[model samples]
Target: MPHAVKTFRPALGAGSVLLLVVAYLVVALNARFWGVVFDTTGLAGLHGAKVVAAVAAALFALTLLMLLPLSLRWTFRPGLAVVLLLSAAAAFFIGDYGAVIDRHALASVYATDAREAGEWLSLRMLAFIAAFGALPAALLWWVRIDWRSAPRELWSRLKLSALAFALLAVAAGVAGKDVASLLRNRMELRHIANPFALLAANLSYLDHARDADRPFVRIGTDARRGDVLVPSKRPVVLVLAIGESLRAASLDLNGYTRDTDVDLHPLPIVNFGRVDSCGTNTATSLPCMFSDLGRAAYDDAEAKHRENLVDVIQRAGYEVLWIDNNTGSKGLAARAKELSAAEGADPSRCNADGCHDEVLVDRLKTLLPTIRRDTVIVVHLLGSHGPAYHARYPAGFAVFQPECRTNELQTCSDAQLRNTYDNSVLYTTHVLAEIVSLLGEPSALVNRMPIEALRCRARRGHAGAGACPEPDVSPTAAVDPGIDAAMLFVSDHGESLGENGLYLHGAPYAIAPDEQTHVPMLLWASDRFAARRRLDLDCVRRGADRPLSHDHFFHSVLALADVRTAARKPALDLFAGCAPSR
Candidate 1:
């Protein structure tokens, strides 16, 4: 309509172009999803670059077909509308897990109080209809207006290069990823590698998603590049309280006003309010956090190529146990212990399909009695994991009510969703406290050393799952000698709830918000570590920015367990490099 519509409109041409764009973009979307999925799981680019090239060829062909229709129609309205709608829809679906989850199936878990599946589907369906289909269609109505002579002799010139232009769109995506990853790092251009780094990331994400069934990386006890371990005097009990879909800004530690963390408020903890994440998805964020690459080297292919804290701790000779409450995608679970499904060997542990995070602690109670030396245990909670926020907690834990009824966040009011999510935070506080209490018991250590507990979030990194809001989180305060030693806590990454249309983590890195990158970190050390080392808890916590990345988590745990590893580095220890006033 903006062009010569009634006279120039070619129905077949318009439809063809639209369809071509849809098919090509789908390929692009799939690639982006893989970039996210495999970056964490280590399943991307396995079949070789040729396979990726093949995918690129197909997408380009479809794009070329799209041009044929566009050239015939010449209005560009259809192509432009398709691009807008699909881009928006893709973001909505990818960022939102509740959108895809079958809600009725969720309710049916307790069949006596089951709700219809359609109700759940309706939430996403209505949202999609309104935002993608309806809004775009309405825009189409306005598109019917006949505008100025926007199409001039430029149109004729465009026709000659149109084929190259259309194909270039797809090729640019492919070249951006390959060229940047291979050459940019060598040239010290990785930080400045504009659209290329972003494209490569999307391509990797798409490749990973397509290969979800493949095994991530083979976890083992061994040394690789940048590995470290050390000796310590106490048994290590790490209560890794992984927040679900958590956005750092929502935390009280990060300056939000809401009291989302019911029990975390009372504890003396170190608060690293400036940490950030590398990637957004659990698959990527989890493993990348556990890797030795730190923030600078955390990338899709390299994530697969590296060793994590679990492997590092194992090399230090500690008995490694992994207790998971969230999906295995987050790198923490993969670092240690048996999967929830593997608990079948001990019927006393978990009897059903899987065990809760608390079950991991329960398993620890059983295992710790026989441990003669130190040990490291990781507890991965399904804290505030969404759509099924109701499932995040047990029946008694629902202190906050009027919870969001369904996972489709779009359906529920913001307050409802907030309340629902905060309940999970309450659960996190309870679990962390429970974990600390368990660690302090005589059974945990032969010497019965008091354990320290610190709460932390990553400074900043990539985004993936929607982040939780811990609005009432407080910053780091003075560390107390009376407190237990070596309390370390930080988020794996920061999150973006819905700033500037950004819903979750996993956006292209350049465009990712500060929320996605900047995280919260906090710590509380025990008197043993404070006194034996003459450690100044308050001063260290106050001026605590020495680039403490997860690379050190691997080394720090080894030092905590008191086991010496050939790969250990003393500088990796937080207390190692400290000096007076400088």
Candidate 2:
């Protein structure tokens, strides 16, 4: 009986389980992070070294993170659960769209309306939540802790923290050169830094929110319409349609070989080929475009409290209305009669995903005849917004075949992705054409002004500057003297369809790629409106190749509405030089 003494080993405690879970996440669940590191570092060629460095760095980072929970013994499990849940969500977005969860992206998530947020919900996300969040959360809840005395627990935490720090320091010292070089050369790697990336982004967003909550500064108080009045018997109706995530390169009118803009080709439209956006995201661009200040001087805090294009138009006695098929007006339509497409969306045009841009068009038909005043209608369209591009348009309009049907765009091939995106653009062309036809007479204004026009305009009065004559018309003159109606379509910003591995918009404007900044600005005017305003369609078309941007939007709209406010910078107006009411 005494021949062999059995050796007993204690089962793992809840603290050990938490540590194991953290280790598993740092190693097994961080594929996206490792992939990003490898791709960005160009370390794929050195496969063995890449794996070794990745594993070592991940373990070191995990050790440092684990110290937080270990230090707070009572909250250890709950903290782990929260971390797991956030990591799962970050993984889902990074995997789905190859998106970097930066501060701008976090802001976009916070700003997303409920309807838009639903587009990202799917079986895949649910499975991810279960595997990465719920299962671990449940395990943390059920596991039993050893529950040592407070003094002992404090000593244990101190020991663990010291150990973690020692290990991290050694690890960092070993791979410091490689890590520093990789991060330095690949700035985007910061966005792919797993849980740390998300934590940093949240902190950045909180800081921004704190700044935004400060008192808003009112701009354009001196805003008043031009003394020159446009007395039209039929009432001037100007439709400024702000398209969403629409890129100029994808449109046929802008030199894309695709038939995305086929429906619009026959119309007398002027497609401004090289127009830039104020920002690469809606939340930034929408307000910036309407503010009296141009992008260079635009401040969100100041812009929020002030009168925008709609406010000035309203003050000048024009009936201003905003019809939205996208997100809310970003506070730009605060003073206007606002309408949402969701209010009247038919089953065919809307679902859980969102209402199509056509819903606004349909509602417009009913509202057009009722308006009896000089009016400005800002139609905000949900045009080609991604990563659910396939859901944007009806099936009939999917001219491109074998489209990518899922929101996980990376799941599809390049052809499938491009085809699906083109389908959305095609749908937008139809929407634009429908609006043009509905208006009966569409006139096109293409801004062909050169970049030098902006630089030279201020110098016109200076010696040796080419004699660019300023408008000689009196303030009391009427610009559009008869029945006037026109539709102007410009994108809030452009989209990036897997360009340089970027799949969506919302990149910060300063460093944004051309794919995200260059947008389409098209104009369609009624024949009567064109004649009444003395606009030369051919001249506007000839100028279509010139450079322009959202800097022109505020002044152009004020000019078009015949508002003579001092806020209107005539030099920035696209129609400024063409149609001065002499």
**What is the lDDT of every predicted structure here?**
0.47, 0.73
**TM-score: model 1 vs. ground truth:** 0.56
Best by lDDT: 2
Per-residue CA lDDT of candidate 2, range 1-582, in tens? 578875553445544665676676666556766776656534555654754564455454554564365436666777777878878887777666566767767767877988789777778888987888789778767666676778876676666567667766665676656676766666665676667778787887666556556665554566554444466568778899999999989886766765577567557888789899998888888888988889999765567766788887787778888999888898788767898877956888886688887898888777777767778888998999888999898876665667899887767898888888888987787788777766664321111223233223323232355655543333232233333678889998988888777778876565578989999999988877777677777877887788899999888887766677677887788876677632
Candidate 1 residue lDDT tens string, 40-121: 3222565435334533444454444444444444556665565445454544455453111111111112221122122234
Q: Which stretches of candidate 1 lie over 4 Å from their true place?
A: 1-123, 126-202, 205-241, 329-336, 341-357, 399-401, 441-487, 524-539, 545-552, 558-572, 577-582
The candidate maximizing TM-score is 2
